[model samples]
Target: MAYGLSEEEAVSSISLSPCEIMGIEKDYGSIEKGKKASFFVSKGNALDMMTNQVTLISIDGVVQSTSNFQYELYLKYRKKDTTN
Candidate 1:
C-alpha cells in the first residue's frame, strides 16, 4: 500500500507473499480445496471498502461476530457518565 500498489495487487500480495516469504506455499496463503477457508467478506471492492465496513469475517470457515467491544462499552457507560 505504501508503494501505491493497486487494490488487486495488494490483495494478491496478501495471498501470495506469505507463501513466498515463509516458504509455506505448500500449506498456507491459498484457498485450496483441502485447506482451511480462512477469509473475510466485504461489501465493496477493496479500495472502495474504506467507507464500507466488513460485513462478515471468518477463520477456517468459522464465522465470527463483528461486535465492537469498545463501542459497546462506550455506549454502556456513556449514559452513566454525563461528562461528554
Candidate 2:
C-alpha cells in the first residue's frame, strides 16, 4: 500500500467529515479555540514532521515552555529535595 494520501485530500476528508458529524463545524476543523485545542502547529510545511518543531505546549491556559521547561522542572524538583 502507498504510504500516504495527498495533503490536500487528507485535510479535506477530516475537515468535512468528523467536524460535521460532531456538530463542531464552525470551530473544530479550524483555529477557533473555544471548540478544542486539538490541532497541530506546523512550521514551514504542515507535513514536514522532521523539521517542524513544537515551540510551545499549553493545556487549559496552563502554559508549558518546551524549550527550557524540562531543565527548569528538574531544577525545581532538585531544590525541593535539598531544602528538606
Tens-place lDDT per residue, model 1, 1-84, is 547987768877878686679887666677787777777777776446475567888787899988898979988987795665
Write one digit per residue (lDDT tens) for candidate 2, span 1-84.
125777776675656568888987775665565765555444565456567677656543456656587878888887674553
Stretches of candidate 2 exceeding 4 Å from the true structure: 1-4, 13-16, 31-40, 56-84
Residue 34's lDDT in candidate 2: 72
Taking all chains together, the TM-score of candidate 2 against the true structure is 0.40
40: Cα error in model 2, Å? 4.7
Q: After superposition, how far is residue 59 of candidate 2 from its true place, in Å?
A: 8.5
Model 1 segments more than 4 A misplaced: 73-84
Structure candidate 2, residue pairs in collision: none
